[model samples]
Target: MISPEERNRTGRGCLLGNWVEERATTSLDKTGPESDIHKKGHQGILTVDWSSKLEDTSTQKSAFTSSKGTSAQQKGFRYELMKEHLIKSISEQVHAELTAKPAAAELHSVTRRDYTAGGFQWVRPTPSTDRDYKTDQAITFWRENFDKIQGVTAVRNRDAPFKKNASFTCPITECLDPNPENDLDTEEK
Candidate 1:
């Protein structure tokens, strides 16, 4: 549930966007709300965890910056209880469609930070002016969010160095060469 603080900040034009990408699970009670809800055996998922970090080099906001994080803006929430319900629900839906498979649930974090910032304290994005996010980043967020469930592996942001983080994925780009001193990894090169 959104809080009073969230409402106030959002009213001031600082919006909140939350997204999730979890692997599909085989546990009946784990997928949507359960902590292990996204345990994989089926495929994957899509959801929001929006922020404003984007493709800016001046303010140093790179496209690699995440839009989602622990939403430490809400005051009080029953994460465990909600997690339980969410897992059951997502599990039901996934299995209902393909009765042969199993699933579980988990809730995205509603926990908030101590300092009050814009709704979720999302970093002001490159297009800091883009509140509604007309048709660019929001669209990419929507597309990438869905792509996870579609079983599409994440590709590296070629402009960014190959590295890993707790949030986004860049599994295969580690071998790319920054200079011609090393062999190129793909035909595109």
Candidate 2:
């Protein structure tokens, strides 16, 4: 079967997923009150009931980010959350950002350092002969170190673009004097 992309491009084949909607709300929902009750028949027989009582929707609503993301799109970013060191420029900036736009901290989560850090990016075994390399130098480095990078020794899904679910992505990255140097001020964990 021809995909949606081919159908859209060629303009000759029939497509089932053709209709596009500006607004996703249903006809019944748009007509009147937006109550939680769901009716199946014409007599308005209630077909659904809430399993758990929701006193407030604040927790659920905070999970969604309404704003369209920024220029830091697709790029891996490093941000600092201010707690102890108020003297640093980035820490002060982060606090200021949260103060000005409180909604910026929505969907914020604490993650493990080793899991998300780039230092642990290539922990898997060496790539097989079937895998494709991004570049000659990259392949050479991988083969020598027995390390493989994504979209090179491994495949990356090319369907839809990946997006960060967090709001207010600050492009600011604070490094010491040099980009490669580690901060000497950090305490031992």
Top-TM-score candidate index: 1
Candidate 2 per-residue C-alpha lDDT over 98-145 given as tens digits, one digit per residue, 9 for 90 to 100: 888444644535565334665555567777665445532333444444
lDDT of 2 at 159: 19
What are the clash counts of all predictions, listed in order?
Answer: 35, 0
The ten-residue window of minimal lDDT in model 2 covers 154-163
How does each model score on lDDT?
0.45, 0.40
Candidate 2: pairs in clash: none
User: In lDDT terms, which candidate is top?
Assistant: 1
Once superposed on the true structure, which residue ranges of model 1 sit more than 4 Å away at CA? 1-56, 59-75, 100-189
